[model samples]
Target: MTKFLKTSLGLVAATSLLFSCNEFKVTQETDGSKFQIHEKGDGKTTAKEGDIVTFDLVIKAPNDTVFTDTYKRKEPIVMPVQKGAFKGSFDNALTHLSAGDSATVYVSADSLFMRVQQPLPPGVTKGSDMKFIVKIKSIQTMAEFQKAQEEKKNNEAKVMENYAQKNFPNATKTQYGMYRVVLKEGSGATITAGKSVKVDYTGKLINGTTFDSSVGREPIEFSVGQGAVIPGWEQALMMMKKGEKSIFFIPSNLAYGEQGSGPIPPFSPLIFEMEVIDVK
Candidate 1:
């Protein structure tokens, strides 16, 4: 995740440099000190097949008023720029870019959706010219990236077991390696053998350290059979019905197998005190 953060940060920082640098239109003979792209790149700029990309993009009008910038987001937006994900100039500009390339294109105001609160202020056409600079960062080959990341996280969940042990001094066992001292059941969720359901839950390592919990602000809604909840959650919750509450001490393999996220280390056990808030 930090790596992803760094890549986004780098993309945003690139835009800041534009303030002091000269704009370069697309050309082969352009100086190498800074990148100058005129016509959009002739490759796949829109992310496809799980590619992660970072780029410095600029939007402008014929009058040169800047409209939007990803730099303001402070993080390079990450997403697969697929068909229908973006329309108009944003989509058109990306249609011609590939990994690590940049481009500047003129998008008609009509295509890019430029808005004016007041009257057109004289001669601005409804489909006036809009300018933009774009760059492509990195690309992944498949959606397996999410799964790979999850596996890496599972490998890191080991440190969480100690957290549960330290905190759940009196936690009792339920079914499928789950445990908790009962709180108000409050009418939990109902589950069939092969149905999807949502749940509110929290998890901690054995050392009383809490790893994660959705019990604070709002109840979490997720499908039971879908990979939405962890394996342990599905296993434990399957034994429960509406209004059921239990304490669950999940083994590492059942939780995050090896990799951890933010705080939990690899191969961690989790103890959850859960109340089935709702089910569907």
Candidate 2:
């Protein structure tokens, strides 16, 4: 989101002073912009405009409260450099940093708030100086990133296939790669496209972490062949009949694909224990 982009530029300010410490030299620019270099890094290449920079960050407010910390997630945040639009002193700082560089920068919250329309936290005053401790995890051009992502996805698919063979060898797979195991046969009405089906379901990631369920809540009803649910769910519901129960192992592509929903990561396989309560 743009909030990430704006927060990335919190180090931008217009003017300069210099200070030195045993570990690193700090260059203080006008309006509370401070850049400290910890390691220049051994990588020959530096991040350029349009390149995606992946970094770990921790942002804290003046009240000593944490605002955002990607380190806690154990995943680095990736942001593309857009030079012409939101170009700032931080972008310039990135050009000097290479992969593996670790540094700290300080910027005036007042100056940052002026550039972007954001409400300050209750404890943060107008002129509070925000601190950013960042470590450059990696840098990649858009093309390179895309290629890596494709390779990763293909590897995940292979793992998913192996998992299915081991856990549900008797299950049948659809053309789109969703594997299904029918637990109970239904003698009631058959499900079809354009019919409304009510279902009780529990969904989880391949790692056994439950993401959602309708165990306590009432069963949900939605029309089939509509974009109301994920493609895998829609497809599986169409093959089921009233009172039928089944388990579906959905590949990432048929489920959430590259863009996962809330609490889900990109390219994650899913498991759904489903029951068709009624069909109309």
Candidate 3:
């Protein structure tokens, strides 16, 4: 019968999500590296700087207790092997390692990582031996890596701009030190040089989820181009006619670029449906 053992890491961290794995098979090692690790992966793999690697690895503590193993986590660990990106035992182990090379490198617990890490079971100190199994899925050069990142950024920017135009037909934009909206259609009220307007608006996310609203809640009263709202919004509302419901699709640049609006993360494209209920 192929029966697997149910296991926990040790005496202290019994409730810790960090757990034991099958790969830490406990096959006695003479060196007492204090732990064991194995990989359920293809024999060998390669890696280079700036490359992203996914691997199924197992790690165990000196007392034959398991701390973590990719097998138990049921997910491959994604590591970006770059100078500032990686540090400590894991990074050191990956240094200069190419595709197809398998290692059972032993590391002292203290040397394991150089990051803000959670403390393991009490007494698990530096110099405690640990074992690991690493398999490199692939490698990419710095140029290739940066290119991919830029492409993703560009695509996202394009998507935000495209979505803004589609959702807010009256979304005109110009950057004069500060983002401003120039024109807005469908506002029913006659917008004069100076007018106090009260508007009802429902703002939504790209997915059409409402984030902010003044509909059936309370009427928002403000002067047009008074800088009370976002730049795009200020520009849009100034040209709106009273009694008209206008939809404003605004890009992050004209709205909140890299820094999104309330509850909205960075780079979020905004969609606002507004009605100029009154103009005084």
Candidate 4:
């Protein structure tokens, strides 16, 4: 997760050098860090510690060498605001802005790398500065965020339930809230934890959009109880025997949950048609 944080926060170095830094009067933070606000927001509320923040970020090195830009990726980061690991850290910088504000914060590269316990990248020196360009998109209190998340979860559950009822009314619901319909029963003992299994699967969204499949390719193999796959897949596979073919309706809680992967949307329930070919 530390690596993920580093990447998401745009700590890595990028090859392209773009955007020239313009001169502006710098405001010194209480921690001695400096930032220049390019745009002031009209928001009345300021972000506080423990608040959930959604924002776009761009990290750059000297000479405007881009490290990462969330705006280009079109995925704004959403995270809880916490105290900085050091005086001039990004976390500390966030508290100084409100929704819709745009600012560029400057921090020492040495201190920044030290906080994340990562070695400085090539061409970066100890006393050099790293630039963080941030755009505040939204902020919500913990209670408000939790309430919204609960509402989204409930809505997703209803969607999945409706889809299951309409398509596979006789599907068996699992303890983890997923539904499964066995298409073909396999012979021999049921799969157990630590056993290696080979499977071919086609995964789809509730809207019938296929995201991934193993058709016309080598079947994927993994050991049961290993974290190589989602919890739903492991649970469902454990309930089946060799040669069994089943379709699983996996709820977001048992799958990707709030932070969806690549093409999957947040709070999305997934559908998978799976066949266990071999168990050893």
Instruction: Rate residue 197 of model 3 by lDDT.
Output: 84
Select the stronger candidate by TM-score from 1 and 3.
Answer: 3
Among these predictions, the greatest lDDT belongs to 4
**Over 4 Å off in model 4, which ranges?**
1-26, 38-42, 63-76, 116-119, 162-195, 200-219, 225-228, 238-247, 256-268, 271-280
Best by TM-score: 2
lDDT of 2: 0.77
Q: Write the per-residue lDDT of candidate 2 for residues 1-280, one digit (tens) a residue.
A: 8997776565342111222344487766542237677776667768888898888877766676877787775556777865422323455556556899887766567766666778876777986766677799889999998887788688886877898899889899888788899999876666878998899999988778788899999998899988899888988987889889999998888888887675566788899999998888
Q: How high is the lDDT of residue 60 in model 2?
A: 68
- Across 1-280, the per-residue lDDT of candidate 3 in tens digits comes to 2232233334335544235544454433332222233443343444555676655566667666676776554445655775433233555556445554445656656645434465555546565766666555555566665576456446765776666556545545544222223234444446864688888888777786667788779889987766777877776665577777766666665677664544564556677777877888
- Candidates by lDDT, descending order: 4, 2, 3, 1
Which regions of candidate 1 deviate over 4 angstroms? 1-190
> In order, what is each prediction's RMSD in angstroms?
13.6, 11.4, 12.3, 12.7
Question: What's the TM-score of each model vs. the native?
Answer: 0.37, 0.68, 0.41, 0.63
Backbone clash count, each prediction separately: 61, 1, 12, 0
Residue-wise C-alpha lDDT for candidate 4, range 1-280, written one tens digit per residue = 9989888666333312222233345778886667888887866768899999988899998767888898776567888999988888888888888888888999889998887799988767779889999999888999998898778888987888888999999999898899999999999999999999999999998878778899999999989998989999999998999999999999998899987885576788999999999999
Each candidate: what lDDT?
A: 0.58, 0.77, 0.59, 0.87
Clash-forming residue pairs, model 4: none
**lDDT value for model 4:** 0.87
